[model samples]
Structure formats: C-alpha cells, structure tokens
Target: MSEADFIARLRGIATDPAARGLADDVAVWEGLVLTHDMIVEGIHFLPDEAPQDVAWKLVAVNLSDLAAKGAAPLGVLVGYSLGDAAWDKAFADGLDTALRRFGLLLLGGDTVRVPAGAPRSFGLTAIGRAPEGGAPARSGARPGDQIWVTGTIGNAGVGLAMRLGEIEPNETCLAAYRRPQPQLTFGQAVVPHVHAMMDVSDGLLIDAQRMAEASGCRFGLMLEAVPLSAALLAVRPDVVDTRLAAATAGDDYQLLFAADPAKAPMIREIADGLDVPVTVVGHAGVGEGVVLTHKAQRVPLPERLGFMH
Candidate 1:
C-alpha cells in the first residue's frame, strides 16, 4: 500500500491527540514535539554520494519537521546501518557537523548491520520543545488566509540534475542537494503568526494540497509566485516549465505557511530580520483541494504533484 494509505489505516489505532491525526509531520504531547524521518540509499541519496552528506540529510530532514512545528530541538536518537568502516567514520563526522550546525545533540541510538550489498538506511527521532505559543498545526488554516513560502525553491532539483550529468555542477546547486538547511530560527520566530505551516520536503504543489486538505480549504496558488533561485534559472531556462518543475520537484526543505493577509507587513519584517526571503504565493478559501493559476488563468494540474511511493 502507499505510505499515505498505510498511515491512514494506522490513524484509526492512534488515540493520542499528539499524533496530530497523522496529518502533521511532528507529534506534540506535553509541550514536547517529536519527529522521525528515514532516508534510504539509492532512493534518497545516490550510492556515490558522500557519506557525510547522507548523514547530514538524514538529520536535517527530521529537524525540518521540528522546524515546521516551531519546536526547539533538544536532541536526537538515531538508527544507523553499518556499512563499511570508512563510510561509518565519515557519517560520524557528518553527524557531528550537522548537530553542531543546528545546535542539537546526539542523545543516544542503536546500530545494526545489514547483509553485505544491502543498501544503507538511516533514521532519526528528534525531540524538541514546542515554542511558548504552542505548536501550530497543519489543520488550522482558515478561509482568506494568505499562503507564503520562505527562501528559494527548485535549487535542489537542479542539483540532482547536476549530479546525474544532465547539467554541469555549480556550487550553489550542488550544495543545495547535498545539504538542506532547515529554517529553524525563522520557524520559531514566525510560528506565533502563522495559521498553518509545514516544510516543503515534498514538492510545493503536493505539500500545499496536503495543507489544503488538512485545513479543509481551497488553495489558489499562482505559478509565477513560486520562488525560484537564481542558481536554478541560470542552469535551466526561465519559463513556465522552470516554475512548474520547481513546484513539482520535491526536496526543498523551506517552510510553507498560511497567515492572515493583514500580517504581511509583520511577516516581511520577520523575514527581513532573519535575512530570509518570503513571498506571498496564493490564498486559501472555503472549499476543498487546490487550484493552480498562471497570470490569472487557470492551469491544468500536473499528473503528479511530486514524489509518491
């Protein structure tokens, strides 16, 4: 079964409200927010990819979930698969770098060794404290809320192309794919102001649909408003496909959020304070599902919004 379908089945048995009805990325209970994320070799990363970056990606992805909830990370428990001695050593170094970069600690973890030739898989469970205002949910968006996104989008997708020889490697694009920085500070600073929020691990379009579904609202997104980094456009042409590709290419860990239109000035201020770029991409209304538009004209939805497994 698809992961979403499998999760739905489990939701019937999860009794705690902190489970967030299996809708939100992180679970919240007793002022603590918990999140777990797993990355698989060949699936999430290329086999030749540096072990350090793989380790960082595993930790960063989980921390991104905490950032969505505006939770301050306390520590993380990791599940690691032993591969080779050199790879393991590099992963350990990467783990240390990521933890120090994000001001997090390695609490404890367990390790196992798979059969020879097995792909490496890693998981991390991050524990954090919800901000003073409380953890914002994915289901709290209301009608007439403005949709916003932080930082740039689509850089990582281009990075993947560079890695695959579809294009020449540039430092910006390569770094984006190898290391995704979670917006930990911005999430905490803006948590109190947003109605609903989540990180864009999946494509912008897919994740927005999820937020719309959870909030029971219709999200009208402007294709042109989806931010694109200069690095991506420099390698790829600036056109409709450029924007659409970024919207549908998952892996950018930027924050996607909903807020009141009146809060735009404040939101801008917060972004400016952090030197993070924020843009208004759309709005929410009393309805179901999402609508895509370009230059005020409705556009057909892509056959696939993002990665699905």
Candidate 2:
C-alpha cells in the first residue's frame, strides 16, 4: 500500500479535533501547534549530502509546518540516529546553526544507534504557539478566495536537478536545495489575513490540490502567474514544461495560502515588510478539483501534480 493509504488507516484511531482527521500538516491544540516530521538519508537526502545540510533540512521542514499554522516556535524535540562521532558532531553544528538562524530552542531529545550500514533516519517534534487570529486551517478556504504563494515556486526543483547532476550547479539553485528558509515572521503576519494556509514542502500543485480537496472548492490557476526565480529560469528554458516542473517539484518549503480578494493589498504589505515575495497564482471557485490555464487557454492537468509521498 502507498504511504498515504497507510496514514489514512490511522485516522480513526485518534479522536482529538486538533488532529484534523490527519488532514492538516500540524495538529492545532488550543494555543499550541504541534508537529512531527521524519526524514530518511537515502530517500529525503543524497547519501553523500553534508551532515550539516541534512540536519538543517530536518529542522527547517518541521518548522515550515509551524509557519503554515501561523505559530511562533517554542522549542523542538529531536529523535536522532547516531552514525559516528564526526558525523554526529557535524550534525550538532548544523542543528545549532539552524536553531540560531530561526531563533528557536532545543527543548529535549533522545539518540539511538542503528544497525551497521542502515540508512540514517531522524525525527523532530516542534512545538509552537498559535498567533492572535488563531491557527488557519487547510480546510478553511472559501469560494472566491484568492490563492497566494510566498516566494518563488521552482528554485528548489531546479536545485534538486542540480544535485542529481541533471543540471550544472549554481549558487542560487544549490543553496535552495541545501538550505530552505521557513517563512516564520511572514506566516505570523499572514494569519490574520488568510482563510487557509499551508507550507509548500511538496510540489506546489500537489500541495495546492490538497488545499482544494480540504476546502471543497475548485482552484483555477494561471500557469503564467506562478512565480519563478531568475536562478531557476536561467538554468531552465522559459516554457510550459519548465513551469509544470516547478509546480510539481517538491522541497520549496514556502507558504501557499488563500485569502479574500480584498486582502491582497494587506497581504502584499505584510510580505513587503518581511522582504518576501508574494504572488496571486489563482482563485478558488464554487466547484471541485483544479483547473489549469496558460495565457487564457485551458490546459489539461498534468499527469502528476506533485510528489505523492
């Protein structure tokens, strides 16, 4: 069975409304937002990847969930799989760097050793406080709400291509893959404005589809409206395929949100204050699924919207 299928099997086992039927990324418990995320060495990161980068990814991904909930991080509890002294030390340095970079604290954690040659795995539990307007939900989107995305869409996808040697490495693209910046302050500022919000850790389209499913609305997205970084466009030709790839690529860790049309100016101001890029990619409508368009022409949805697992 698929990982998603397996997760669905566990839904009824928990009754807390905070769990959101296992639909949202993080559990909202009163004023506290709780999340746990796991990453595997071979699956989530290249085996040769720097320990520091892996550690940073581990922390950043979880914090991104908090960002989606419009929460201020309080601390983290890490579950570590020890490799060697040198590797663990490097991971510690990376973890310290990530914590300091985000102004977070390490509350507590445990470490363990795996069998020889086993793929390294790590998990993190992040605790955060919801914002004044309360934590927005993936299922809160209303019809006619504008779909907004923070930052450029496809830089990390390009970075992944570079990491896999499919494309030559560049500073901007490589940095995107190795280090992702979670939109903490921006998320907090947006909580009061957004009807629904989430972090784009998976490909933009897949995550957006999730929002659509949760919201019970049709999302009409303009292909040309999706933002792309100069770095991504420089390495990839400006074409439909490039845009599709960007939409379907994962690991961007930016925010995807829906707000009323009237909130555009306020949203832009918030983003401007944070020095983050925010764009209106589409709008929600009184229907289901998603509709794609390019230059006012309807296009069939891609066979794959984004990462499945």
lDDT for each residue of candidate 1 in 188-281, tens digit (9 for 90 to 100) = 9999999999999989999999999999999999998998888888888888888889998888999999999999999999999999999999
| Model 1 CA RMSD to the hidden true structure, in angstroms | 0.9
> Mind giving the per-residue lDDT tens digits that candidate 2 earns over 171-261?
9988988999899999988899999999998898889899999999999999999999999988899999999999999899999999999
Local distance difference test scores for all models: 0.92, 0.92
Clashing pairs in 2: none
Clash pairs (backbone) in predicted model 1 = none
Q: After superposition, which runs of candidate 1 have C-alpha atoms over 4 Å from their true positions? A: none
- What would the TM-score be for candidate 1 when compared with the true structure? 0.98
Error at 68, model 1, angstroms: 0.7
Lowest lDDT 10-mer window, candidate 2? 6-15
Question: How many clashes (backbone atoms < 3 Å, residues ≥3 apart in a chain or on different chains) does model 2 have?
Answer: 0
What TM-score, computed on C-alpha atoms, does each candidate reach?
0.98, 0.98
